[model samples]
Target: MSIRKRLSPEESRTAALEAARALLIETGPQSVTLKAVAGRIGRTHANLLHHFGSASGLQKALAKDLASSICAKIADAVIASRSGIGTPRDVVDLTFDAFDKEGAGALASWMLLSGNEDALDPIVDAIHDLVVELNEFGSEHLRDSTLALTLMALGDALLGGPLSASLELPRTAARDRAEAMLLGSIDQAGTLAPEG
Candidate 1:
């Protein structure tokens, strides 16, 4: 029999994480058993445990990986929103697009349902940065604007398609209204930022 090539600890961990991430996006967190991930990565479950210390460790690492990817997209959206290059509608559309395209909405739902609340920290931190940007831009009520925009975009990602089909509304009509309202609020607050 031929000897198998050895994988370094880092390579093994990365391979396992990539497998877990793909599985998470495809079947949700519920399906990410160590055995499944190990099989997907062509490693033994013990090998994974050796690297991760335990199944919980693997899940935690996977959650962190997923959150980081999702958070980066959100951060980019917030960066765009801060720039003032795009209108409010543009910001809203980009936010929803980022969530939907990444399947982040579903991934988040699964991770939270799986009792991995730690998964949300990175995304929360990213949003915090966005709020700070809005505050610096002269938003009178940073809390309200952040809450409204975030909830609106997330709702749109989760329900926009089905709602659009049921109402016979254009897929983007609701988003358009929400964006207009978001812009209206910002306008009412006034654009004191340099970009304006």
Candidate 2:
């Protein structure tokens, strides 16, 4: 005696992806299955399969979505930092939070371990595109800084808590180091810039 609400295909897909992301953040990457997403969205497994082709397809779509969303925010933060409206720590926190609180790190590692190595393409491509787009900022060390920041964020997401505890350091030790590195890179870049 229940009526199902009708949704367009795009709406359905978006809903499924949102549900999958929620599952990723709430439960972990291992819980982001087609069935679970479908259930979360009140759709059938066949519906999700139709939209995504398979579980791997769903994961790839989710990864692409997460990358696009996170990169856009990071890009905004980078722009703010360049305009002196934000600090390097803002960028560092966003990057680290994307990996940790947003579940990108866990999802990426799970995809790799599950043999869906190509699922990482979206993440890599997004980072590459972000760097390229931001290259107009004119920092020769931007790429290096990005690499260091991303690796540090990912590593911290994976082990910073336990490692920091074991080392008797604050939980934010890695984030602090990342902020320092970014600030140093910016200073060095400024010093090397040609005089106007």
lDDT of 1: 0.70
lDDT of 1 by residue, 67-155 (tens): 46654655565556758654566667666764565455665666677777675665566677656744665555555766776677677
The Cα local distance difference test for each model comes to: 0.70, 0.94
Candidate 2's C-alpha runs over 4 A off are: 194-196
TM-score for each predicted model, relative to the true structure: 0.70, 0.97
Cα lDDT of model 2 by residue, 19-100, tens digit:
9999999999999999999989889999999999999899999999999999999999999999999888999999999999
Judged by TM-score, which candidate is best? 2
Quality of model 2 by C-alpha lDDT: 0.94
Error of 1 at 88 (Å): 4.3
